[model samples]
Target: MRFGMALPGPNVAAVDCLPLDVLPLILEHLTDRRDLHTCAQLSKAFHNAATPLLYRTLDVRVTMYTGMQRAIVLHPSTTILQRPEYAKYVRHVRENGAVGFHRPDLMDDCRKALKMCVNLEGFTWSDDSAEGTDEGDFMRYLDILQTLPLRELVIQTFYGLSDSVWAKLQDFSGLTKVSIWCMEGKPRILQGWSEKLGASLTHLELGVSSLSRAPHPLYFLSHLPRLRALRLKGAPSAAILEILTFLPQLETLDTEYFGAALTRYDDVPAANLRHLTVRTSSVHIQGFQQLWPWIRRLTPRPSLESFTLNAFSTQGEALVPRSFILDMAATHKDTLKRFKADSTQMTLKDIECMCTVFPNLESLSCTTMWSPESAPYEEAVQKANKLRELRLNLHDWRPTHVRLAGLNNANIEVAVRNMMLREGAALRLVGIGSIVYRGQWIYKKAEDGSDKVEFEITSNVIKDVWD
Candidate 1:
């Protein structure tokens, strides 16, 4: 009887005594996957607890083939391929099946892995071929997708899918967000198919290759009652306006180009629109003036929240006037929150005028081709009090003898610094200089009421400066 008596170590009993539910909570705190893998190997209980968390969010991107190879090499001991318990954690992959000449066996294994992931919520299919054909394999993968309900689906194809596969997508009733980047001719067939699934779609992105022609698939989106976000690139402005008229509840509208013809259709207004982005070299100050007035004339004017203009170019030798920007901001001041302009030859005075108009703006970013004249820095700072994010490009300022006549390097730096400080707690990011000053960049951040500024100058800039 005495020989049968045994004693336990001090912490041994306590370690085994902890509840099984607490294991997951502890493993979640681990930051690195290697640390989690080590924890999993400690015991079978630990393995079961950590395996799901580790296997969740599987990335099968073409770029991550090395990681896939490693996973395959360790498949025998890890048994992740055969284990059903790990399937629930698998939510996404860059590709669904195999392709090309390498690793032919990986195709079957990857499909098997995908099948086990019946609870997947996100899926992205990116084809590497510039002109390669994968229609059959793509169709097979789409068939498999029908089994899993997904919230997000992203498809990037160098060429378009077959019409049969596009028709089969009607069954994807649970899809809420979809992004399609199809080859030039392929998007034409999508019109009817998109209309079929329009009721359930909330976010839709279409990137086409043709900008001069009408988007053939435009009619398919005419009934997207639930659609809130719509992004169209490389499509004619007429087609874009046609789509905008259909989306009654639309919240976001982003277009790559605004054709000169858009001015003719100013009579059609998107009343429910809130966020708008126009990345067009065609838009000038005059075009914007004509466009904004029509937008303001909507019966129930849209509460435009965020506006972005990119790649804007002006005719002849013209600079964006300070008063013009100020007037535009004042017209939409009540509902605006974020305002951005890039690639415009504007001056510091023009930016300050914008700040005065949209004093409640939370995010402000502008690329000016002309630096400020050494006037009063406080005036610019006072106008940008509510700015949260600020981006100023001194390189955007043209170094004309006329503009930089009286300004020196010290004066330019002081003016830029003052503009940033005015953003206060709202400033989270800042970028300075151009290609010539490539490495000479400054960034600042504020945390817990403390401000930190960092200056990083590249070797190229330092060498050129000293040379």
Candidate 2:
């Protein structure tokens, strides 16, 4: 052994003899933090190898509270931070909580811990939206993000960023993926943040955020040639399609909450977009007759591959126009691999269109109120040779259940799952799903473990997440 250690009897390799560098390389592959934490306590050699990997992604929400964050947790007196050494290994810092930072002493300790993260590349802060004018408040904590090799910044709200803070952000470079969600859209924010942060960004997501004056913030941001991925939400539908035309290089887009309106516009030019997702969150938008009518306006793109249209109304009774499904399925038929839609209901014609139009589809989902005899889904199931994943949204069974006619009152809901696997024999898996009729439409995993999802909807609650 290199460290003057003798191994027991026959086997000669000592644990210490393993190159310290090689151990860190091996430890990187150990993803379970619990296992890594246990390994870190083994010896100084293992500790040194595992500690860096442990602090690699500093999620403040968990890091502030987790017992595993030994280096940052306070002592019995709750007045001291134990190890400053752990901070340097942090590369991603996500701060979604403000637990121990109330006292100046504790806040300093937290900042001191963060100051050592010179290698931090990613940072997210959700509490920056507070309106308190306290100097060196949460913004001071945010300034710590500017120092490191910051690459991704996902800030929740910018409620009180002054001009100076905004100016600092403009000069702060090296950002690539920036997602500003739930922003208050104060006057100052609508004016400059996009233009300030737009230059260095490649993947930008602005959801439920507002912009200043006439020429929309997105319209102004379209000039930035570097943008490749975009997600726009809480904007008028009238302006969104036009904005897409402006960004010809965009490869991916996810948008929703388009304020319903019938603003007449010319044909939208097709870009090299590959993945597109359009969603209508609130059922309040009455004009959301269908997702395809809005999508059909766009000129066809040969590069388009994935399309998802989630049209959710309050009543769970919104319709997804057949023309929209057929047209989209036809336009992206060649390259389309994944297609998901949540309409009021779907029929055999819709399923046939989807199965036949998309031969290369690897994944397909629909919020269809399925019946055993409604459509011969078997029709196109054979043609969809590459089909691997299929998710169906059927009516929940309880008081009155739809049954497969011949199968002894067999819930057609369950029968549909078998039908998919039997018909699309090439399918890798068929996931059976149903929207909750009552409390939050949650998708619960089937306890029986036949790769099924069984949900018992209760209450009149509602959920916002996509099915």
Candidate 3:
């Protein structure tokens, strides 16, 4: 007798059944590499949707090595080399010169794989090896990279670049962003880059162990008419802003915040500057004293959107003077949205004043000492109804009288949650007492069209929010 064949089950394509175009758009939002890896195994469609996202940024940098280990693990570039198609998905590659030391053949693999990355747009090269470790001709990799469609270049090395490598970099005309940090002697790498890549270079960062005594480290940078963001280390704040007089299109500046006041400020022009970060130490008192006047001289009122003053002191705690806050509020109150001052002290009254004065303040971070039950804390949050994020460093705030009673994590969470419920409907993040919680307000439209809001708060590790 003839046996009947088993019937086919219902066809179900799972979530991967979405159109090829729509599926990629959804998969691209997956930030966790583990999730993307799992999705890549679901089906050919899912693999196609997630492969590019997974391989988009190839980080083959060797972070660590131990003598106890056997042979070094093969670099990811080896896989890209074997599977030529995966090379096409690598749009950015971060490599440390140490990768070659881990295995002599790794550099060859990286060079071959990089060539296959015809669409590569960004490249980050770092060398963390000991001083005498052979650099193994950076020119080899640069030669292949120059042929690609690279647009962003970042180099942080302990040793200086050879003249040939620097010249090869000058030939890279399509670069839109360049960051070079050399821990060696004074680096004069920006000599002629302005004439070559200035039209496309919008973001530039330069750091060096030593700086020349010239009026400005790189005078040629003034020719970069389209420069929009400039970050400099080992450069005086006064000298950094002097270039701003020439960079009319510059919108953001990050630099060491110490220097003498500008010798000639009367001719200073109004800049489009929006975000400024001064990462420095309080040891430079004279420089700090001159900083306020320099900021005030920016001409005209309020255009800065974010200001971060990260000042640390080796002698004792540094404090941001209320006068400085008052000056900032007077000039930038209307536009300042994010303000961060770390390691420096801000009192409860200062925090309260910031909230009350800066109507548009969205993110505020500072080290402050305030009793959770104090009126200043209450007033600060009440006025900070519009603040979207609040981060406070209160490690120094644990007073002998209230440390056992009120400084515990449980109590702090309860007190902060109450503050959020009472005010700060717009608040989404609260960080204090070495703890971070992320919350969101869920709103419903009322019958009268007024909004009714509900909220949810959950504890989160620091990296989850502010990595």
State each candidate's clash count.
6, 1, 0
Q: Distance (Å) between predicted and true CA of 345, model 3?
A: 1.3
Sequence-dependent TM-score of model 3: 0.86
Question: Which residue pairs collide, candidate 2?
Answer: 439-458
What is the Å distance of residue 160 in model 2 from its true position? 4.9
**CA lDDT for candidate 1:** 0.60
Q: How close is candidate 2 to the true structure, as a TM-score?
A: 0.71
Q: How close is every model to the real structure, measured as TM-score? A: 0.70, 0.71, 0.86
**Which 10-residue span in candidate 1 carries the lowest summed lDDT?**
458-467
Best TM-score goes to which candidate?
Answer: 3
> Which segments of model 1 are wrong by more than 4 Å?
1-56, 61-84, 96-101, 209-217, 262-270, 282-302, 312-324, 370-378, 396-428, 434-467
Tens digits of per-residue lDDT, candidate 3, 20-69, equal 89867877777778878877876777779888988999886344456645
lDDT of 1 by residue, 259-286 (tens): 4444344446554678888766642455
Among all candidates shown, the one with the greatest lDDT: 3
The root-mean-square deviation over C-alpha atoms between each candidate and the true structure, in angstroms, is 9.5, 9.2, 6.7
Tens-place lDDT per residue, model 2, 53-88, is 887876543233446433253321121136565666
